[model samples]
Target: DQQVKQNSPSLSVQEGRISILNCDYTNSMFDYFLWYKKYPAEGPTFLISISSIKDKNEDGRFTVFLNKSAKHLSLHIVPSQPGDSAVYFCAARDIPGGGNKLTFGTGTQLKVEL
Candidate 1:
């Protein structure tokens, strides 16, 4: 079974609007949660992240909310821009054998329209 899941395959939003993406995890050992944005023919770039100790974290137009009790997280983008169009992946860090590894969820494609 997949430890991380993104139920939505895609999302669309008009420019200057808000876009919301959701993610869920089944692993309680995961403490660090991150959101990455990926473009065609390119690697995913880190976006926003939140630690299990914190309920919410925000940077500029991007925000990440984590609910430890529910094992859920959500990413919110305010005033979404065209450049923001990309596949967003939710990832969690797993430290096993003293090594840190990331488990990523199936990405959610975000399209921003003018």
Candidate 2:
């Protein structure tokens, strides 16, 4: 079973607009959530994260919100830029996997139209 899931495979947004990517989890025990952005061949870089203890966290134009009760999380990108076009991956770290391996979603490709 996939611990994390991105319902939308792709999303397109206008330049300078806000893009919201949603993710859901099945395991209620999951405690940590993270979001990563990738550009083509490069590896995904950590964009934002939200701890189970907190409801939300923000960094620059990126924000992550976590709802432990609902087992849902979301990443919001404000003023989406053309350069922000890339694949986004939602990840979670929990027990039973051991060694802190991140469980990831298939990925959502975001396109910023100018």
Q: Please report, in order, the local distance difference test score of every candidate based on alpha carbons.
A: 0.94, 0.90
Candidate 2 residue-wise lDDT, 5-50, digit = tens: 9999999999999999999999776778899999988989988888
* lDDT tens digits, residue span 18-94, model 1: 99999999989887989999999999999999988899999999999998999999999998999999999999986
Question: How far off is residue 88 in model 1, in Å?
Answer: 0.3
Per-model TM-score versus the true fold: 0.95, 0.94
Candidate 2's TM-score reads 0.94
The alpha-carbon deviation from the true structure for residue 53 of candidate 1, after best TM-score superposition, in angstroms, is 0.5
* Cα RMSD of predicted structure 1: 1.2
Q: What clash pairs does model 1 have?
A: none
Error of 2 at 84 (Å): 0.6
- Which stretch of 10 consecutive residues in model 2 shows the poorest summed lDDT? 93-102
In candidate 1, which residue ranges exceed 4 Å CA deviation?
A: 96-98
What does the lDDT come to for candidate 1? 0.94
Model 1 TM-score on a 0 to 1 scale: 0.95
Model 2, C-alpha of 28: deviation from truth (Å): 1.4
